[model samples]
Target: MLSRRLALAVATGAVAALALGTAAQAAPARHGGHGATLRTLAERPDLLIGTAVDASALAADAPYRAGVSSEFSSVTAENAMKWEVVEPARGSYDWSQADRLVEFAHRHHQEVRGHTLVWHNQLPAWLTSGVADGSIDAAGLRAVLRKHITDEVRHFKGEIYQWDVVNEVFDEDGTYRDSLWLRELGPSYISDAFRWAHEADPKAKLFLNDYNVEGVNAKSTAYYELAKKLRAQGVPVQGLGIQGHLDIQYGFPGDVGDNLARFDALGMQTAFTEIDVRMTLPADEAKLARQAQDYRRLLDACVAVRGCTSFTVWGFSDKYSWVPDTFSGQGAANITDENFVRKPAYTALADGLRAAARRAGRH
Candidate 1:
């Protein structure tokens, strides 16, 4: 949501437990050589490999649709389920486009991770304006927010595997981001949001998602402390989402494994939720090679952590990447080019998954 992430723009587009043989048995990649699809390699490690999907592109582009359907076993709606798209007019809700996505997931035999139930960005105008003008008093704001979470969660209750109950709530400095909810409701908003979401879908794992928390730094420490507090209060806060939006220019976040280890110690689900490594300007073989290592590094961290159950790329192709638009002079963040060709980073992920499968097999 911040500079570290303009996470999922539009365009683009795991696991199991079983024998290594079982992974080998899963479908081979359409274009991948001797190696099976990333989804297949994930089976033995019992991890979910996924991507943020652009619903419009899925509907109109055949190659994009095929790529999503075959390459990943889980899907998150890039913007389909966001507040502005689903509840554009406050009380008026439209689930047409979002429902199509859920259906597509079902048809592809993919699990769905709800993009978010609470976020400061992409909010509908009516809600923000109401809050701005004091038309939505604190109590009224609370009620409205509760209703939004309840309705959305209840509608897709049993189908969704997880819900990003609160997203990008904290800034890089470890302070709660100033927003309508924070200003009116104070810090209690995070716990309240989780409670409301849990009440609506008890089966779904509720997660606190944010960027820049890929390591055990200030931002991640804030999440760790808050998650510990929430769970102690019986808040049903069940997961931590690390948005792995890395940049090759900054080098990889070396402590990602250590960060995920701490969360694993918390005994809650953790995931590399939205990962994409970007470089500055034109891509060279060296930059691309380093990008591959970055992708491999993040995926390796997740595979090594017991509680980390999923790894997802923000989007799969550069054709529809949000990077160029959001960050000037930085592009080539995805694993594929515009024509759906795989890159070194794509192979790196496949290799990581295979290694995980081998490890799982050894055990």
Candidate 2:
């Protein structure tokens, strides 16, 4: 059986499959464009087209590296920057993999998004065990948390453009998820995490990121209230990251524009952080077409909102997606297929960006 963490990692894939099946339909053609790279199309509007990348893939996968460099203007380390990989042992740290990714992004002139200073999943065993064993007290945990955030942020202070200070802190129903942080450090941990990250690197934009909050729903409402409260208290919270992990079956987020607008109204920048539209196995033309439509809708939502500056796919190609393993019988959730072939969704993204560019009078 898959561990709950792995299951949650791909939970969005399952959610996509369930939510979109009945709504899957042919998407109408809105625009036509050819051979436009995401970077070029986004340049005119000052929008950043980015992707989450596995660090090993950056060094080992030639074609994947080329694809990323040629297309995206920003990159986020999918797992390398997470707590498990960065600080597996108490008071010990490793920066090899994360450093490699930051170096690669700088070499390619791509900005970096530091993923997650605080998350419940993917935590180092020692930290969780300490909590579980009662060896680490609440005050000790708070000190440890501060050390982790400060050290990580300080190490990459100028290199990373943004930091996801807190990730997936809320449950789907708008309540705080019962994580170790909340249990030990309480609700103040969230605000403390953001403040610590900011103090470490005052220039890096700090954000709270979550999935299933892309539309104007209960989950998003939670974020809106939190953003408003954080700002009122003068927390260094700057942005909201909506991980747009779409599945063809769930249909597109209809109220995405309104949801983004609400966040923007609170003086916060918003971003489509991790986007991918997946479908069940044995993908057909209609499924692919619907995926294309979903992709377009997400990009359109970001473009329609001011201060919605960045749009990043979870990963660019289906070859390395975490979907299939996490969601049985479901795969191909990315814009490109396994062989680096441009799928319909790829063209749809280009078309959307091109249209946005033209509308902004960049063409």
Best lDDT among the predictions, by candidate number? 2
Residue runs of model 2 more than 4 Å from their true location after superposition:
1-35
List all candidate RMSDs to the true structure: 6.8, 10.5
Itemize residue pairs with steric clashes in candidate 2. 19-249, 19-250, 20-249, 20-250, 21-249
What does the lDDT read for residue 45 in candidate 2?
A: 30
- Model-by-model lDDT, in order? 0.82, 0.83
Candidate 1 lDDT trough over 10 residues, lowest sum: 1-10
* Candidate 1 runs further than 4 Å off: 1-30
Candidate 2's residue-wise lDDT over 265-346, tens digit each?
8878898899988899899999999999998988998999887978999999888999999999999999888877778998
